[model samples]
Target: MTDTHSDDVRPVQPLQPEQLGTYFALMEAVSLLQHQVEQQLRAEGDISYVQFQLLARLAHGPGPLTMTDLADGVVYSRSGLTYQAGLLEKAGLITRGPAPDDDRATLVTLTGAGRALVARVLPGHVEVSRRLLFDPLTDDDVRHLGDIMTRVRDHMRARPPRSAAPRKRQRS
Candidate 1:
């Protein structure tokens, strides 16, 4: 019998030496920065990075947002987000309820405690970020990095995650 899947195979280009170096450097830098930020957040608020993200996003929003919204914003799974939201609710940091407009969606709201925690930890968060990620960069470098990151983020987000199939327009 002859193989029939030849058409499915496509040649792909490999990364150049410089491209590989850049990729490794980016990964290492991000990992190191995240580790430091995580340590700071855990030390200050006893919350994981994801938990802080959820709370911080909620705190910044105008009103209660759905779990879907939080999941998309934090780039986390819906189930994982649910678990995190549960932990926050138990801690008296947030509240979860049915969205008035959508019965299938669970809305997450930051409580007073949650807002206070963000305010408490934000100073350390900023300090850690500046020290670890920004201290070596000039203003121009920072601006260029912001532009590059935004473009990269948009490119990645253009393809909706498998978990979020059938994408909706991302919030501005």
Candidate 2:
């Protein structure tokens, strides 16, 4: 006979010591680097890092993307996306329109001005990124890091998020 407690919920096990160390080191490095990037974006581009990411995403997309599609590509909530889109629209950087194919969906497009803003921000942005992310690593380290990151990202994304967890405001 099976033990009565077997079916009871079992807490997830903690990561092994080495795994914990690696996990935290990665998080710390990413957090520190992101902080520097945010400062650079604010000082040079006069935009928040998230705003820069938003503009870059719209600019790179084949065309206007539906809000749902855009949200899937970046880390943001549906309501939060609407607010950010409104800010860009107010700044004349992007335009939001009802999706032609899907009346229920909204589409976002990057304007010429938006394109220009992204272009202007790229030089400084790339410099800062290289300084923090790429400059310290050797060629082999770059390749290895790319592979590791790609694998990790793919593995994590393969699992759908649980209940679309809400996060606190990520930006001002």
Candidate 3:
């Protein structure tokens, strides 16, 4: 452990048992929720969670966005996103084309098929989401959980992994 004030290294202290238990419980909850959602998506839509996410992003956004923008927005690696895009294209769910002004950038957009898929799958998706997320929590619990997660996500966004000390954010 490094002293927060002085930066002196010391032996790291483990979390108290209760703290560890709570942490593990939170992780378990997240894993279970994700698994349930994934199962529902696969069963109902024949789409992996990642693919569904990509389609959902395109369907929800205002307009077609660049590949880089999609990659960043979806928190996916460039290569992985390229492969997923190919699958989507093959399925006639989305189209990839060159950006009109920027020859280097590829833009992605949903086709009529993709929009129809979203419209088709959304009811089951919402049902599963509500069953796993909202059904177990009170209104106040949901609000507090949302607030806490938002703060946690923002803090993580500001601080990159310690393995890669953050560089300055780049503009598109």
Number of the predicted model whose TM-score against the real structure is largest: 1
Clashing pairs in 1: none
> What lDDT score belongs to each candidate, Candidate 1 first?
0.89, 0.83, 0.85
Per-candidate clash tally: 0, 0, 0
- Per-residue alpha-carbon lDDT of candidate 2 for residues 35-145, written as tens digits (9 for 90 to 100): 998898888777887788789998887878887777767767778778888898999999999888889888899999999999988898899889989999999999999
Query: Which window of 10 residues has the lowest lDDT sum in candidate 2?
Result: 1-10
Per-residue error (Å), model 1, residue 32: 0.4
Model 3, span 89-108: residue lDDT tens: 99999999999989999999
| Model 2 ranges off by over 4 Å | 1-9, 161-172
Off by over 4 Å in 1: 1-8, 161-163, 166-172
Relative to the unseen true structure, what is the C-alpha lDDT of residue 145 in candidate 2, on a scale of 0 to 100?
99
Best by lDDT: 1
Order of candidates by TM-score, top first?
1, 2, 3
Of the two candidates 1 and 3, the one with more favorable TM-score, higher being better, is 1
Cα displacement (angstroms), candidate 3, residue 10, comes to 7.9
Q: Estimate each model's TM-score.
A: 0.88, 0.86, 0.80
Residue 161, model 3, lDDT: 36
Q: Of the pair 2 and 3, which is ahead by lDDT?
A: 3
